[model samples]
Target chain A: MGTVSTVLSPPALRTGMALAGAGFRRWATYRQAMLAGAFTNTVFGFLRTSVMLAVAAGAGGVAAGYRGPQLATYVWVGQGLLAVVQLWGWTELSDRVRTGDVQSDLLRPVHPVLSYLAADLGRAAFALCSRFVLPMVVGLIAFDLYLPHRPATYPLFLLSMLFATVVSFGVRYLVNLTAFWLLDIRGVIMAWLLCSNALTGMYFPIAFLPGWAQAVLWYATPFPSILQAPVDVVVERGTAGHQATVLAVQGCWAAVMLAAAVVVQRRAERRLVVQGG
Target chain B: MADRPTTAAAYRALLGAQLRAQTQYRFSFALDTAASALITLLDVVSVLVLFRVTPALAGFSFTDSLLIAGLANAAFQLCDMCVGNIDTMREYIRTGRFDAVLLRPLRVLPQLVFGDFSPRRIGRAAQALVVLVVALSLADVTWTPARTVLVVIAPLSGAVIFGAVFVAGSTTAFWFVESGEFANAFTYGGRDFTIYPVGIYPGWFRAVFAYSLGFAFVAYFPGLALLGRPDPLGTPGFLPWCSPLVAVLAATAAALVWRVGVRHYRSTGS
Candidate 1:
């Protein structure tokens, strides 16, 4: 206990780094799953890019303010980012809660949230290298995938991706926390899957929605901070200030959701009733 | 395998037990159903969003694509409701469940695919049906009696084809335990591919997903028949009416693959 360090302290940072490395190693073993996921993403990439190109053909080479290159970048890179941000079902936390394995998580010196975040970051790093690159390679041969115009946009996009990962973790942790009171979290997870895919632009750009709908999604929900904002960052969607503002919004959502998670965990601690020995 | 009546009764019994267990959490079930419906409805909205940017996709009008999308959606969801759990073959194998299943006096395919139902999928299927009904009403089809029969036959045929895809794809799990995403690329990815006119895709893509696989028969060809139009990609005149034949062939292939898979199953000796 004397050696234990608070969040961001040296020892805690070391622990987080180790956890992240472990996470990276853990997922790296799933070689076939990686190949399968990449194949699926690339297939869907062709489906999406083809349709968007058709739309471009119909609109005389520009549709919804995106040219062919922009559409290619959006569809392909966004498909890669799908696994990076993990915009769908993940139930490990809730499973731990149900099985009472979370008690072991609590007994650790490092905080559960911090550890999980670190591990997820590791997972994202692995995905960014493997799953993320595969679709880009496939898309490059087939379509005009876009690259950032300014050198500065690259680092900004990286920061946005990091923020997106944090925001996703925060939102998912809160969703998982619902298991504290619910008999089953499957509905919650399904509902999350359905809405997040739509709102986060997994199916199509939130930008392609009616302007009012886009604004509502952009401002009112943290969903876009997960996938849409990061992609927008890379595509150089607007002026530098607009990109900065998008990054800022992502940062804000990440902070807000994480704060909410901390608060919820505090509350759940009060109702701590382990289910099984 | 059990007697026909007994197998049918077993399916009913298993499905009933599953429904009871799921409905025991009434609130979650309702929430999930609504979410499921809304999720699928968003797929329709996604197409509308595409049309908002363009008047036509590869010469198919908004309503024409809608029929294609709706038909594919309805068929995929029906198959998803029935055979979707074939994606869980890895788990059944890994847990020694396949071994137990083999010992049972029940037909493997029905026990595996048809013995469970998730009510949430009903919401998705129902929403797709609504889309199909809407697309049918809105599309500029000249309603011949033959076309009318196509309306009834097409979706059922498409569903059979998709179910076959699910079975065929998941049979790979017999070799690769973690083949979920591989199977999903065809079952789910095929749904996305079929929703638009085949002309929108590139030549190689069309050759692979549409001609090589049976996805074209799911919606594009049937859609052509419904609209009384030729394929924009120059599919033959007789192709539109070939969905039934395609469905039978796909089903036959799937049955063979599943048989070989079951024969090769060496379950976890847990």
Candidate 2:
């Protein structure tokens, strides 16, 4: 009874710990890969800073709501936060579905969706540590990167990042699920990527957007709550409350996406007939 | 030159087979194309919206930025379609299917080129045309023979240069199998950096492009010609129309690296 009861507890938590362990194992083996990734990211961060500085140059005191040093701080914070948020690499579950490896996953007592999410969170967290953190530290040394002043910002920033990760993971999960229903998902994935890039402000700051665009972002997508909100908290330490509100918005969005994913996965599983020898 | 016609016919046959295989699920293909078109359209829209926020970006007006963006989109899509096979070559190499191409009668390059043709690239290309049209309408350029020639050659040469970059990147599979990820940075990441004018970058970044292999062809010189702006890099007048020259050089570079890669593949037998 004890063994079975322990097994029957929430699959997400049990699988989450197991998957996180697996992530750590993978990280150990792929240390070199992660280091290389960090180096590449640091190089790009420098390039991006140059572009922003060029744009903000010739202006008097403040350009795009940031002074020179503060703007540098924003870029460093954004890059560091990128690890905690973890945006790159999509189509994990979809590839499994396509290759028919998902058969074993479906047989588990834990829902395949939850299992996949747990596993992804594990892998992404490892990548974040090895890739994002290391690079940002190097960037801080080389570029005189600034950190947030107030102590309160750290806790709120962590909270915001966690919320952002959940929301982003949910979005990616749902996007991957579409491959189960659709025969060719590359185009759809590409299109989704384009939207996510705009919404998440991967290319630029959300503050750079126009009023109508900002309104559209708030209502139409959960993008602003992801990268932009977390970075906002870092740059403006006093705005932790606003960041918390954004985190709340992100939680709601996550719940909505998770619900949608469950429904879709159920429907797709019923129709899923993997035809092979 | 002797086998050009036959090679062309063979390429068409391969393309037809690939398209039909894709079209087997017609509804999915149609839906994907529509969705992709919408998504790409939104990306352009986002840029326009950003431009509306501020009258200028790094001293570039909305219309000028649109022109640069349109050209980049068109060039990238064309390259994507042509070398779509190379993008997946690492998988083929890992699975040992690359040997099958080596065993074929035709040249390895032609066989590779004909291997894959993603129809979705057309969606990207079409979206780029819409961007170009909008930019043209906004600009007050009097359409002349010279302008038409510049526009036509600009995207074509840009595609060639970009395709060469992919080929060079894909050839790196010969040296480091896992280097595919980093190879992507130079092509896709480089395209992003180049979409804006070279002048916007720092002196060091500009120096890399000036000295780097693929940068001049992809965006630097041709963009100057297309924009009709004085060469920010102090390039000569004739250098602006140096697209074809860049294309030839890139192709030569790709061919040489690919030849060396083929030798490596033979020796490893993997």
Candidate 3:
């Protein structure tokens, strides 16, 4: 709070933006990879949509508190958000940590956490335009999506999405930071990947789970905040107050995760040996 | 042709070496096995979660659906254990490792696949097998001798089908370095597609993925055969028993594709 006034000074802002742009450019160069990702997402979108819609139809046009259109929104939006949130397949930090490139990163003027977050934000931005857009259009054409009835839901959903990205990056950063201590982080990474995909609303809606389980997942675990909360916001899962509450929870997780990531990174930096000449 | 026996022996030795090396790291193998078991557990939980929302999915009840899910998953895991490393073809090509691979005496596909083979990966298939057994006991299907025979044959046929799909999908790596995600659209995507009732999908999707691509034969038809039930979508009655035939056809196509891919490899020459 004390440094808020100078936080956005031109130099700092420029550095953040430059790193973000570099991140965007680096990812954008893999155009075919992006296309393949979108294609895969769209395919899964169709499969999930069909299954969820069948559930909805089975339950007499509503399944797990979601109507047909809402289910469509959930599945398609989930497919798009899957790439933007990047539930798995990120190991850049850990790779750098392995090769001792992280020492150079620490030598830079900018904080490592902040700089990496900026780059991730840029990657998310590029994904938003590329892989994300395709699923949105495909969902619109293939299914009846629930376009947010309330005007305020739009911005709130966007905010929740941005926060989801932060929460995801924070978790990812902490997971990668394990490489400093565990040279072979494969087990840790595998555990993270399994949990994120299985529990994080990637395969199916958590709402379909039993009430106790859903409550535990939404409130106790960060997985729902990373995915389910934002989709809930878009589909207007609850009243205005409830939407606000979900967003607030997601925001809190974002901040907590970021702070935790920074602390772990600091500890890791002190212990980093940078072995080999 | 006369040297086939030696080639087979050499391949077994290579795969044995890989398995031995992997088991040397007991902790990592154990963690992977635990994670694999956990993943299978979650697969059941996800399906149960879906059932909590509705009584049935496209005319299949919870137990009925589990039969499909278990068979599909067990078969998929078996295939993954066998030829999943074929996906590393892109990296091998990019890192100029394929040049050395080409210099080898044995065939390319078998070498690439068996080179990293790990039998411990059967951990996942074992978990899926548990689910299949549970589904058998709980589900309302009347067990007959024919049904028992079908159960024994289905998962093996399904593995063959899935293995073919994997090889066919990875074949694209010969031309496109970034073909991994595209291959996943069929490989992993097919697993996700098969775990649910195929009748739930739309007609066109079922035609392309379930029938044309042979994903349905992995579990759907075999499941129907086991249950002695006809498909809700009303295909021919004998479709359920045709999975072995489909598996053969798909494997043949995959082998042909692999040959074409190996021929197309001009080598990075770096």
Against the true structure, whose TM-score is highest?
1
Q: On a 0 to 1 TM-score scale, where does candidate 2 land against the true structure?
A: 0.86
Residue B38 CA displacement from its true place in model 1, Å: 1.1
Query: How much lDDT does each candidate structure score?
Result: 0.86, 0.69, 0.87
Q: Regarding DockQ, does 1 or 2 come out ahead?
A: 1
Estimate, for each residue in B1-270, the C-alpha lDDT of model 2 and write its tens digit. 778898778889988998888788766677667776766565456456545445555666677767776677677777776775687876667667788888877787767777777677776787777777787687555566776887888778778878888888887767765553656666765666656656666677567754465565565565556667776567678877777778788888888887888888732355
Query: In lDDT terms, how accurate is model 3?
Result: 0.87
Chain A TM-scores, candidates in order: 0.95, 0.88, 0.96
Which of 2 and 3 is ahead in lDDT? Answer: 3
TM-score of chain B of 2: 0.86
Clashes of each: 0, 0, 0
Residue B20, candidate 1: C-alpha displacement in angstroms = 1.4
Compare the candidates by DockQ and give the number of the best one. 1
Error of 3 at B92 (Å): 1.8
- Ranked candidates, highest DockQ first: 1, 3, 2
* Model 3, C-alpha of A66: deviation from truth (Å): 0.5
- Which tens-of-lDDT digit does each residue in A153-230 have in candidate 1? 999989998999999999899989888777478789888998788889788878788999898988889999999999
Predicted candidate 3 versus true structure: per-residue lDDT over A40-151, tens digit per residue: 9999899889988998999999777899999989999999998898888899988998888888999999889989999999999999998889989999998889999999
Report the Cα lDDT for candidate 2: 0.69
